[model samples]
Target: MPTEHVLPATGPAKVRTRPVRIGVQIAPQHASYETIRETAAALEDLGVDVLFNWDHFFPLSGAPDGLHFESWTMLAALAEQTARVELGALVNCNSYRNANLQADMARTIDHISAKGGTGRFIFGTGSGWFERDYDEYGYEFGTVGSRLDALAVDMPVIEDRWTHLNPAPTRKIPVLIGGGGEKKTLRIVAQHADIWHSFSDAATLERKLGILAEHARTVGRDVAEIEVSTEIGSRSVAEVEEHHALGATLFTIGITGPDYDVSHVADWLAWRDERNAQGPLAW
Candidate 1:
């Protein structure tokens, strides 16, 4: 593998004029598939821009052995079930499957979700982290560095497989990478991601983005081309606004379990409308 490059930071972060998009990650744990299925439909009907699920074999919270559905398989089902929302795993684990297999699965789901026009699949992926997921599923629970290294190696192969697949993915299938590792993760984001998802607050996001820009410059790409995405879990509107001011356009709220209360979703939708109504070019 080629050594990843890190260059000196230069220039202020570019201002983005993209319209704000709200996303919801319906946690698949502790809920029946029927409940999850219904929640996905409800979110789309409520006008969320994207729907996501985590890629894990078991629940990250609540009971350890709670009812949990697989990410990609449920995503394929959601592809047929929903009409408007773009959907994918919030971040699929690169260690779970072969790179080419991941590409093919994503392509099939892309086609399944297209509804005869364009697909709504966004390939959000990351290096594996959860230890139990690896142990229970018989995958190597390597160190973080090794897992990230594997991801770096797999990405080009995944992208290359897309080119050679029989019926290519619809609309080039936007790639969303989730991580904030300055040297490794951001380098992958700079090289391949159309959107970068991180869990940073405004100040950290601002600083990390400067690092991201340096990586982009090292690879001769514009950092502004990668959309900034952040989680809105329990964040107040004002807090989300802080991130928004720093050019993070895609905000996702996570709702979990049987009830899957969407009371908060309406607030986010309203925020999205308020931002977008200012016009795309509006600061």
Candidate 2:
């Protein structure tokens, strides 16, 4: 990517965020609970800033009927198993469960993790996708437009439920909204997310930032307040620096289960440390 095409500082509105961080999504498909648990421990031990599992009931690749695990139940256990490393679903389907119930569950997991150390839970969510996961799991497979509408409507309810929870959450849980849809998704992100995650390249990221910035203005929120997250799984460290310049701070790598190879992560982690040392706000 050309430096000229690099993202503007702090995005369109010039709002800056904190230091760069690394996250890993340990996909909970095609593996046993024991293997999944071990992978989670290994990731935390590898010093990932966050650990994520997708909220799905079936394998996304390879055999369609491969081994898979339930998300929230597994998350509750991970909350107890790991002493550190902020954890959550990479993106939980908003359509599966009731909005208020989701909030309550997030709060419970928050407390569970807090008992070990600082509350390390991120409420990562997305407008429900994956048709098979819905149909087989008994959810109404609504259209994308309907699901986005539901997301927009339910978020307010979810936020309200958080305030009314009995223990009131260990701290205000950070919400990570994933997707790159311009109209509905970006609007929801600007309105509610603490982190906005997307999988796009340098040029595309810059274009998306412009859209997100516009949405932020419409929602009366600072775009910089939401940390930018991107998947760095396939990109080289050199390729990632371009995204860093383009304003992505939370770089995530995906590890499929059964044979979760994370040897590649060490290179990215080293890159993260070197960038952080340059200065608190350096890209």
- What digit string (tens of lDDT, one per residue) describes model 2 on residues 1-283? 0112113654444433467789998888888888888888888888889898899988888898999888898889999998878899989999999999999999999999998456888999999789998889799988999999999999999999999989898888999999999999999999999888988888888899999989988989777677888998778778888878877888899998788898888878888888877764432
Report residue 189 deviation for candidate 1 (angstroms).
Answer: 0.5
RMSD of each: 4.4, 3.9
Instruction: Please write out the lDDT profile of model 1 over residues 1-283, one tens digit for every residue.
Output: 1111122234743334578899999899998998998889889999999999999999999999988899999999999998889999989999999999999999999999999989999999999789999999999999999999999999999999999998888878889999899999999999999999999988899899889988999999977678889999878889998888777888999988967999889988998998888864322
Give the range where candidate 1 is weakest over 10 consecutive residues by summed lDDT: 1-10
**Model 1 residue 85 lDDT score:** 91
Candidate 2 TM-score over all chains jointly: 0.93
140: Cα error in model 1, Å: 0.2
Cα error of candidate 2 at position 214, Å: 0.9
Model 2: how far is 182 from its true place, Å?
Answer: 0.6
What is the Cα-based lDDT of residue 173 in candidate 2? 93
